[model samples]
Target: MILRSQRPLKLKAAFICDISLETFVSIIKTAYSYFTLLLYIAN
Candidate 1:
C-alpha cells in the first residue's frame, strides 16, 4: 500500500523536475483539489 501510494509521487517528481516550478505546483494543486473533492463526496 505504501509503495502503491509512493509510486505516483515518484513519477510526479520526475515530471515536476522536467517542467517549470510554477506549472508543476499548479498541476499538483489541481490534482490535490480533485482528490479532496472525491474524498468529500465519499465521506
Candidate 2:
C-alpha cells in the first residue's frame, strides 16, 4: 500500500520537473531572440 502511494507521488514530481524545464527553455529562447533583435537594431 505504501508503495502504491509513493508511485503516484514520484510520477507527479517527474511531471512537474518536466514542465519546469520546458518553461525555462522557452524563457531562454525568448530572451535570446530579444537580445538578437536589440543587437541588430544597435548596428
Candidate 3:
C-alpha cells in the first residue's frame, strides 16, 4: 500500500535529519575546543 511505502521514506528522512544534526553539533564542538586551545596558547 502507499502508506506502507511512505512510512519507510519518512523514517529515512528522519534518520538523515538526525545524522545531519549530530554532525553539525560535533563540528561546533570541535571548533569551540580549537578556539579555546588557541586562546590558552596565546595567553
- Top lDDT hit: 1
Per-prediction TM-score = 0.57, 0.56, 0.56
Count of clashing pairs, candidate 3: 0
Question: Over all chains combined, what TM-score does candidate 2 have?
Answer: 0.56
Tell me the lDDT of model 2 at 12.
32
Model 2 lDDT at residue 16: 55
Task: Write model 2 residue lDDT over 1-43, tens digit each, in one string.
Answer: 8888565322234455534455666778999999999999999
List the global CA lDDT of all models: 0.73, 0.68, 0.68
- Summing lDDT over every window of 10 consecutive residues in candidate 2, give the lowest-scoring window: 7-16
lDDT of 1 at 27: 90
Give model 3 RMSD, 1 decimal: 8.1
1 versus 2: better lDDT goes to = 1
Candidate 3 has what TM-score?
0.56
lDDT of candidate 1 over 1-43, digit per residue (tens): 8878664442246555455567778998999999999999999
Q: Which portions of model 3 show Cα errors greater than 4 Å?
A: 1-19
Number of the candidate with higher TM-score, 1 or 3: 1
